[model samples]
Target: MTEEKRIPMATIGFTTEDAREAARDSFYLDELDRQAEIASNSIFHAIMRGRETKNPHDPRVWGALQNTLFATICIARLLKPGPVREYPGLTKQQSQKYADERGEKLRKMLDVEDDCHILDVKAVRDAYEHYDEFFDRHLRDVS
Candidate 1:
């Protein structure tokens, strides 16, 4: 055998805080990617299942679609501009204000001229997430 090939290695240095911050950012980015994958997979499943059943109303199709919507909402939340490393303690109103500001900035940064309607599906996502509450409210109204 010829002489063994040598591999090069480099040392990167960072403060402890920088390392922690990088880890947090990595986690957030990974989560965003995971949610995106989930949304993509769920939509694909929904389409395939819907075609196979020839029924848009099929429960399995609906389930997959719901998953897609939920995952999309999670992605939207993850994209909300904010500190990735730490949760800043803020009152509900203040937090909402901050989010709104950040959201506008994010939209501008992404060059999004029009609102993404899919992000508005948070209400639908909530309905699916809290189905029991939805059912109870409807049952009460019916009674």
Candidate 2:
């Protein structure tokens, strides 16, 4: 009888964990994009309905507006890196220094308008992370 032929399994290039992680990352990125699009659509609908009814305080309008802001904050968080420390371990000066350096790098990369710099987005993310304190401290300057 002829010897039986043997075949080896082929490598598809990625390990199992690597493939899983890649799939998770893709899902996360896609979800973020989906949420951003929904928020943008909500904003348009809210404004249009408010204008038509001449009632800016309508519940749907207000709810949609709030969701839009929340989604914007989420997008900002996704764009920038997370804080180095979760707790308040760093001094105010050190925190500011870190933010400045990061902001500059982001600005150079984005090349966006001055008002919409990464630093501004980072500030919003910080507020969401520490809402009460940050709001009180920089309410006027948050714009």
* Candidate lDDT values, in order: 0.70, 0.63
- Model 2 lDDT-worst window of ten: 78-87
Error of 1 at 18 (Å): 2.3
Clashing pairs in 1: none
Write candidate 1's Cα lDDT for 40-107 as tens digits: 99999998888899765799999888898978877677555333333378766677776666556545
Q: Show how many residue pairs clash in every candidate, following the order shown.
A: 0, 0
lDDT tens string, model 2, 12-96? Answer: 3465987865565555466567767977898998888788786656988877876776777665554443454432777866776
Question: What is the RMSD, in Å, between candidate 2 and the native fold over all Cα?
Answer: 13.1
Model 2: lDDT equals: 0.63
TM-score of 2: 0.48
Q: Distance from true position, residue 124, model 2, in Å?
A: 6.8
Each candidate structure's TM-score, on Cα atoms with residue i matched to residue i, is 0.56, 0.48
Off by over 4 Å in 2: 1-17, 81-143
